[model samples]
Target: MPKQNFNEKLIARLKTNPDFVDESGELLPAAVKDHAWKLNHDLIKFLLSDPEIKSTFFDEIDGHWVFNHNTFIDYINEKNFLANSYTQFRNKIGLNIDGKFLPERGEVSLVWPYKDCVLEGGQTKEAEKRKEIFFNEILAQDEINQMFDPKVLTNWKRHTTEGEQDVTDIQRDDNGTIRENLIIKGNNLIALHTLKQQFRGQVKLIYIDPPYNTKSAANTFAYNNTFNHSAWLTFMKNRLEVAKSVLAEDGILVVAIDHHELFYLGALLDEIFSMENRMGIISVVNNPAGRQDAKFFPTAHENMLFYAKNIEITELGRLSLTDEKRRDFKYEDIYGKYKLNGFMRRGDNVRKEDRPNLHYPIFYNEITKQTYLERQSDDDIKIFPIDDQGIEKCWRWGRDTFALRKAKYIEVKKIKTRYVIYSKLYEDEYEGEKAKTVWNKPYYSGQTATQGIKTLFGSRVFSYPKSPYVIRDVLEITTKPGDIILDFFAGSATTAAVAHKMNRQWITVEQMNYIETITVERLKKVVGKKVKEEGRLLEDIDYDTGGISKSVNWQGGGDFIYCELMQYNQAYMDKIQVAQSSEELVALWRDIAENSFLNWYVNAEVPEEAVNDFTALGDLEAQKHLLAELLDKNQLYVNLSEIEDADFAVSEEDKVLNSEFYEIR
Candidate 1:
C-alpha cells in the first residue's frame, strides 16, 4: 500500500495520545501549546510515548534521545500540513522583494512568505475541482517585467444600441487616446498590468468588492494570521500595487468590505496609499434587517474604505439635498431659507489658548442687529464668547473671516443681559450637501440588487450583487461624464452597467466563466437592443429599463468594446480541468509536454522511470493535478510582442486589432 502523506502521518501519531486527540480522532489545539521549543515537557513526553514517532523524529545523542525542534516545527508549519494551501510552493517560489509580510505589530519586515499564481483567485466555476498553479511573484527584476508584459487581446466586438459588430479597427482621438469603454475577460492581476501601459494615471475611479475570505473570519489575528489572511494580503498587495500605478493623481479608490477583513485590508491600504491619503470610511446599511446567522451583533452594514491618490489635489462631488433635509433650514431671508448657529466653537480645542487669534471681542450694534470686529461705538456691547458656566471659548471664524463675510452672513441677537453672535446658514449655501459617512437608504440594500438582476435575467443569476444605485452614487461623487472607471472584481458588471448609463467610460475585468453567461450578457442588456418580449410576438427595441437606467433617465445610446486576453497555455489548462478519465489526462499530458512551456523547475523530458512512478499512483485526479503543475504560469496568455510569432497561431485579423489597440506603428 502507498504511504500516507505527512498530514495523515501527523494525525495518526497525534491520535495515539489520548490527551491530544478528541473523540473524533482530531488533534486538540490546546495539546500542541507545549510543542514550541522550551515551552514545556508535555509534548516531549507524548512523543516519547509513541515508539514509532520517537524513533523516526528523535535521535540518540549523549545517552539521551534528542528532539529536533526546528525540524518538527517545520513539519508542522509546512504548506501541505498547515491549514492554508497557499504556501505549498514556498520552496519553489520565493517571496518578492517588495512583498513584506506584516507578521505582527513592531515585528521586523520579513518576506511575505506566501506566493500567488495566475489561478490564485480566478477559479469561480466548479470551485472545488479547480487545481491551483503556484509561481514566484518576482523571481528577478528583469523577469518580472516579462511576466507582466501586456497581452494580446482577442474577440474584439463593440456592443451598442444598434447591435453588436466585429471591431476590425480601433478608433483613436487626435492624441491617440482610445475613447471606447472596455470589458476584459481574464485574470484581473494580469489585466491590470496590461492596462498599466496605456491607462496608467488615467483612471478617475476604481471600485471593487473583492472576496472577503469569510471562512477565516473567526480568527481575530487578521493582519498577522499566517495562512489564509497572509495569502489574501499577498494577493491584494500584488493587485493594489499595480492598481495604484493605474490611478490618476487625483483619483479615488473605494473598496467595499465587511467586518471580517476590515482591519487587515485597512492596514494594507495604509501601507500602500499612506494613511494620510485615506479620505473616509463610509458605513452602508446594505441589509437593514440584519443577517440572521451572525454570531453576535446582527450585521446590517458593510464599510467602504475610500482613499484619494493625492489628498491635496482630490476634489469630492456633492449630493442634492432631499425635501426633508431642506426643512433643517428653519428661518427665511432675502438670500434663502436659513438657520442660525452660534459663532462660538464647541468641540475640542475651543479654548482661547488653542486659537488666540479667534478669541478677540466682537462689538455688537444692538439697535441695527449687526456685529463688527472692532468697537464701532462706546455704547456698543462687546461679546467675549462666554458660556453660561462662565468659561471662555473661541469663535468658529477668525477676524479676517468675520470681516470678509459679516455684511452678508453675520447676525447679532441680544437675549436678556448677554449679546450673542450668530452666522446665518443659508439653504443655498448647502444646495449640494456633502455625502455623510453613513448611507442607510432603502435603495442601497442587497435585496434591491437581487430584484434588479431578476428583472434583467428573470432569476437571481449572481449572489450579493451590489445595487446599481450604490455604484451610481459612488460614481456620482468620484467621476465626471467622461472619466474612466475600472472594476477588476467585476461581479455581474454592476459598475460597468452603472458607468454606461451615467455616460462615464468604464473598464471591467472578470475571470469566471460566468462572465460570458452573466457579466457580458448583463452588459448587453444594459446597452439595450431589440429583444423578444416574453408575453408578446413583437421584439421590443429599447434600452434596458432595469437598474439605474430608469433612475438616470437613460435611453441608452453608447458603445463598449469587449475582448479577452489571448489564451496560450491557458487553453491547455482549460483542457486539463475538464479531462475526465486517466486515459484523457494521459493524452493531454503528452500534448502538453510537446507544445507547452513547462515551468522553470520542470524538466521537459519525462524520464521512463518517472512515468512508471506516476502510473503507480493509480489516481486520475492526482495525475491531472501533477500534469497541471508542470505548465509555466507566466505564459498563460500570449504577450503583445509575440503576436507576430507563428508558434502561438495568432490570426491575421487579431494581429491588426492588436497593433491598433496598442497603437503600434
Candidate 2:
C-alpha cells in the first residue's frame, strides 16, 4: 500500500476546525500578516528525514519528485508522523516567512501547502490518479461542509427594494439606488465553489447563457467567443456544480444555446441533469437572421431546454387572455349524427339502419331550414349541403351521441349552417384546433441596434427588450403560478421583469460588470416608472411592489465590502513595494483591484474565531483598517529586523529572481 497523503489528515482536521487555513491550522501568507518568510532549513531537513516518506512516496516521477497520498491508511500514518514531528513540518511550510503563526479571520480555501505544477501531460498514471483523488478530497473536505449551513443562507433576509440606499459619489447607482442586491466580483469559479454548501438544492431556477464552444471554428452561433470548446466547457462545468447545488427542489436550469454546440450542449446537459426529467425544447427566436440572405437554412432559432424537478409535483399555474385562443374547438358532421374530426371517423360501411336519412344525397338543416352540402362557409348566400351521398355523409358517431347534440342545439334559419351532430360537437376530448406545424416568431435585433437606429432613443425610452411576451407564451402552458423563474443571462434584466409581470419572482444573475451597470440603470428607470405608472407588481389588494419588482421598503440598500484574490505573484508584491503613498496605493491596487478581482463570497466575517480575532482579510474592511493601524504604529522596525537575518544569496540559474532585501521594515 502507498503512504498516506498529508491532505487527508489535514482535511479531517479542518472540518472540525474552522481556521484550517488560518493560524490554528496552516498559517496565512506572511504578506497578509505584514511580515516576511523566515528560513528554517532544519525543518525542511527533518521533513526529508522521514526516510520511508521520502524514498517511497517522494521518488522522482515524470521528472518531478512529488508525493502521492490517497488512502485513509496513508493519511492516518502520515498523521502519526506529522503528529510526531508536527512542529517540524509546520515550521517547514512557514520557514523563511518571518511572521509568527498569527490567526486570520474569515473562511478561505485551504488548497495550500500544495506546490503548483507548471509542466503538464507527463505525470504517471499513479500520480494522475493521486491528484484527482486529492482534488475530490478537498472539495468534499469537512471544513468546507461546515462553511455555511443551507438553512442559514435560506433564512438570510432579502433586502427591501425601498428607501435610501448606500449610494455615494464613488459607488452610486446610476438611477441612484444605494447599491445592488449582491456584488460577487471574484473568480466566479471560486465564488461558486464557496457557495456549494450554503446554497445546494435551494435555488428555484438558474438561467445561464454561457459562452459557446467555437474558438476552434468560425461560427456566429455562440455566447462567449474567446475560449476553446474544452475551456468553455471547463469554465461552465465548475459553475454548474454550484448552480446545480443551489437549485430548489422544484427548480429548473435553462441554458441558452444556438446551433453551434446544440448537440454537444444537449449531451452535456443530459449528463448534468439526468435524461429522465428533461421536457421538450422550446425553439425561440433570439435574432431575425433568416434564410432571406443565407445560403443555408436560417439558424435564428435558439433552444431553451426546460428541465423540471418533478413535472407532476411542481406547483404550476397560469392566466392568459381566453379570447385569443382559437375557437374551432368542435365541428359537426352532415350525417345528422354529431360526428367529430380527427377521431377514428368510424363507419365501416354506410349503414342505412343506423340513420335512415344518412342515405340522402343532401342533408337539409332543420335549424336554417336550408339544404346544406359538405361544409358551410361564412357567405351571405343561402346555400347548403353538397352531397353525392358518398363517404362524407356517413354517420361518424353513434346515434345515441347525435341525439344528445340535437337536444342541446340552438339555431335560427336564414343562414346556411350544419345541424349540430352531438359526437362532432359535444364529443368528449376532441383534438380541437389544427395547430400550425411552423412557428414564425422572429428574433429582433438587440437594443444596442435599435437605440442606434433611432437617434431620439437615448438607450432609454422603449428599451422594450425582447418582450416577456415571448417567454410568457412558452412558459404559460408549462408553468403554473408561483414557480420561481431565473435568468443568469439577464440582459437588461428583463427576464425577471417579465416573470414579475406574469406573477413569478425571478432571480437574475449577471456576471458582466458593464451589464450590471446597465441593469441597475434600466431597472431604476423601468421598475420606478412602472410603480409610478402601473401601481405595483403585487397580487394582493394592498400588496404593492411585489417581490418580483421594485419595493417601497427598499433601503436604496445595504453595503457590501469588496475584496480581491491574490495568487502570490512576485510582480503583485513589487507593485505594492513601489507604491509611494496611500493615494497611489488606493489608486494602483486597492481601488482598481476591487473592480478587477472576482470575489469568492461575502459574509459579516469569516467564521474562524481565532483567525477573525487576528487577521483582517477575515473581515475585509476591518483588514484595511488594520493596515492603517499597522502603518501608524510604525512596526516597520520589525520588518527591517527580518530582512537583516535572511540568507541572501544569488543563483545564476534563477536570474529572473529578485536579489533585493524585500523584507524591509
Candidate 3:
C-alpha cells in the first residue's frame, strides 16, 4: 500500500488520539505542527511554501522544529494576519489584550490603515503618487543605526547670566565640585541613546510629557503628520526601552498621557515594566471644566503612569500637611499636639462576627478616666462600644495589639453616662499625607501650565506646557536634591527648570526648531538675575514671578551646556535652504550626489544619472525642488563610524571627541 501523505496521516492520527502531535516535545520539520491548530490546512501549506516566511518564522534546532519569537512577530506584521480580528489571533497565541497568558505576546503589532499599501492599489494610488513626488519614508534598521550612531558633543557653549553671556569658568558648589546640566538639541531617541554612554543606570528620576497624539486638528500640540497607532507604539517602545536602561535601580519613571492613548500606553508599560514593578496610576485634573469638543463625556483629566526599576528598593516621599490638615491636631499634651481619634472600627465589617479576635472587651477605670486593653480580674470596670445612639462598635486594634500599645488610647470624657474612649495621634509622629490617586486641585490645571510659560517668556510661545509646580510636586515625592532628572520630551524645558530650581542636576532634549527660541530661552531666564523682555532687562514692567523660580530663590549664576547633534544630510539641507535660484539649487544637488551618503531606504531604484537628467528638464524650478526632495531628511546626523570616510572630511579634534564619547579606541 502507498504511504499516506503527511497531512493525511497526521489527520488520521489526530482522529485516533487528540494529543498525537505532542506539541510540547521536539519534532522534525516534516512532522511538526508549526501553525495554529485552528488555521486552515491550505493557508498553512501556503505560508510554509513562502521561502521568506518559512526561513524567518520557523527554525530548526538539532533537526527539531522551533519557532522564532521575534521573526514570527515580524511575519505577522508583514502579512497582516491579525487584521480581521485581534481577539482571534490573541486566543490562538494564548494571550489576552493585557499581554498576560501561558505564553506571552512577546512582540505586538497594531493594525495601521495604510501599512500594506502598494503603488498599484485602488485607494492608495494617490498616496503612491504622493510618495513618487514627496513623502516621508520610514528608515530601515541599518539606515537608522548609521544615522543615530554616537557623535561628538561639539560647540559646547555655557550660559550663566543670560543676555547671551558666555561664561568660560564653570560654576562650582560649596564643596568646590562643578555639576553639568545639559540641554541637547536633537531627536530625543538618538540623544537618549548617546547620553547612555555617560548616564547609564545613573538617572534617579525621569518625567516626560510626550506628544499626546490626539489626532485632532484642534490639538495644536499634535505632530504635523499624525503617526498611525502602530508607528506611535513603536516610537514609544523604542524610547521607553532605552529610558528603562538608563534608570537607576531605585529610579522612578513618570509619564503624562491623555485619554487618547492612555490604555495603549498602559499596555506598553505593562509589557516593559512588568506588573510587579507598576507603582500606581495618578489621575490629574488639568481641565476641571472639561473640553467642550467631545462626542460623549468631555475629558477633564489626564493620567500619570508611575513605574519603578526596582519596587523593593523604591521609597515614596510624602506631601507636606496643609493648613486645613493642621487644624485637625488642635489638642496639645506632654506628647505634643495630638488629635483624638475614635477607637472603634466603624467602616464595613465592623461587627463582632466580622473580627472575632477584636470583639474582646477593654477595661475602663471610671475613677481614673483611663482605658486598659485587658480586664483586671473583672473588678476594674468594662467598656463596651455602645454609642449614644445605642449601636455596638468594635475596637480599632486587636486584643494583643491593643495590650502592647495601650498608652496611645485614653478615656477623655463621659457622654450621657457612657465613657468615651479615644486614640491620641501626635502631630510630630505624623510626617505627611501620602499622595492620593486623584489630583483635582486648582494648581494642577492647564491654566496654571499656561500661566507658567507666560511668566517665563512673557508670551505663550509653547502650547499646553506642563506646570512647573506639578513637576516639582512629582520630584518632591520621587527624587531628592542632587538627584539626576531627565526629560526627553522637553518641549518648554519645564522639567529642567523645575529640577534646577529644586537643586537637582538635569538633562533635557528637544528636537523642534523652537528649542533655541523657546526651551533654551526659558532656561536662560531661569538662570537670569533679572527678567528680560525685548532683549533688555525690564525693571518697570510688572513681571509675574509666579512659578517655582521665586520660591526657590533662583538667580543668574548656575550654568548649562548647550549642544546640537552633528549634521550629515543637513549640511546639504543648509545649502538647499539658502539657494538663491534654481540654478544654484541644481549645483547644490550635484554637490550632494558627490559628498553626501544617501539613505539606502530612499528610492534605491532611482538611477544615479537622474541628477544629470533633472538638469535638462525645462521646468528649472521643479527640477531644483525635486533635487532637494531626493535626499532623505531623516538621515541628518552622520554616524561616528562614517566620519572618517572621504566623503565626510573628519576634523582631528572632532574625531578625538567622538572616540572618547563612545569610549572606542
State each model's CA lDDT, in order. 0.73, 0.37, 0.63
- Alpha-carbon shift of residue 192 in model 3 (angstroms): 1.4
Q: Residues 1-665, candidate 2, lDDT per residue (tens digit)? A: 32245444333533342321333344222211111112233422433455544554355678765443322223322323333222232233231122321111212221111111221233332132111000110122222332222110100112223422322222223432222233222234444543344345655666655544442221321212112243344445556656777677777766766666777677777777777767656566545564354457765555666666655555433333322332443345443423334211344554554455544333345545443333354432332222334334344444454445533442323324433322234333332332122334332234322332122223232222343345545445444455555455454555554454555444454333333345444444323321232754432222223222231132122222121221212123234334454444444434323322212221222233423233323333222222221121111111112222333222232111111111112
Lowest-lDDT window of 10 residues in candidate 3?
109-118
Error of 2 at 131 (Å): 37
Ranked by TM-score, the better of candidates 1 and 2 is 1
- List the candidate 2 regions with Cα displacement exceeding 4 Å: 1-205, 213-226, 246-250, 288-298, 310-389, 392-439, 442-457, 460-467, 529-665
Report the lDDT tens digits of candidate 1 across residue range 223-313.
2122234456667788888999989999999999888779989999999999999999999999999877787888999999999999999
lDDT of 3 at 346: 85
Global lDDT for candidate 3?
0.63
Please report the TM-score between candidate 1 and the true structure. Answer: 0.69
Cα lDDT for residue 258, model 2?
A: 61
User: Candidate 3 residues 340-446, lDDT tens each?
Assistant: 88887788988777876777667877666566766655456777766567666678888777777776645456667676678778888887778999987787887
TM-score of each: 0.69, 0.43, 0.64
**TM-score result, candidate 2:** 0.43
